[model samples]
Target: MSGLTVTLQFSGGAELLFDKVKKREVELPALEKFLPQINKTDWSLRELLVWIKDNLLRERPELFLQGDSVRPGILVLINDSDWELYGELDYKIHNGDTIMFISTLHGG
Candidate 1:
């Protein structure tokens, strides 16, 4: 199967959980990489969260993920638009899409 390329950005302290790397261009498999456990063919933010946790996340996963979704106070944007506006976790991922995660839990 082919791959879907997407841009991922982390900021507002979210990057700290990803080895402090703020930007990344990732190519995810077109088919569900986790089979049997996941029967879906398309990739969604919900699945991406698991993928990130298993692949991208370096440490302290609790800081980035709360259950199946991102921790509270973390803002997620897809293609520069709010993830909530795009069906949140159910949104289907497309090639060349940009996903950004920003933590709002930090103090000034």
Candidate 2:
């Protein structure tokens, strides 16, 4: 089966938690690649979040996530628009989509 391809970007110190990767071009595997409990033919940002945490996050998961979504203060943009405009975590993952995570949190 053809894989789903997309672009991922991290910025505003968010990249520090993801091996300092500012951008990535990824090819998501088939449905089997998603969490075992998930059953679907399509991918969503929710699944993408978990996938990123599992495959790309380097450390301190709590800094980036809370429950099933991004911790508060983290801004998510889909194709340059606010993720909230597209149903946030429920937003479907589309090929060539550019998903960006920007951290608005800072530590003293």
lDDT of each: 0.89, 0.90
lDDT of 2 by residue, 11-106 (tens): 999999988989999998775556557677688898888889988999999999999999999999999999989999999889899999999999
Scanning candidate 1 in windows of ten residues, the lowest lDDT window is 29-38
Off by over 4 Å in 1: none
- Model 2: how far residue 24 lies from native, Å: 0.8
What TM-score fits each model? 0.93, 0.94
Among these predictions, the greatest lDDT belongs to 2
| Candidate closest to the true structure, highest TM-score | 2
> In angstroms, how far off is 57's CA in candidate 2?
0.4
Clashes of each: 0, 0
lDDT of 1 at 6: 90
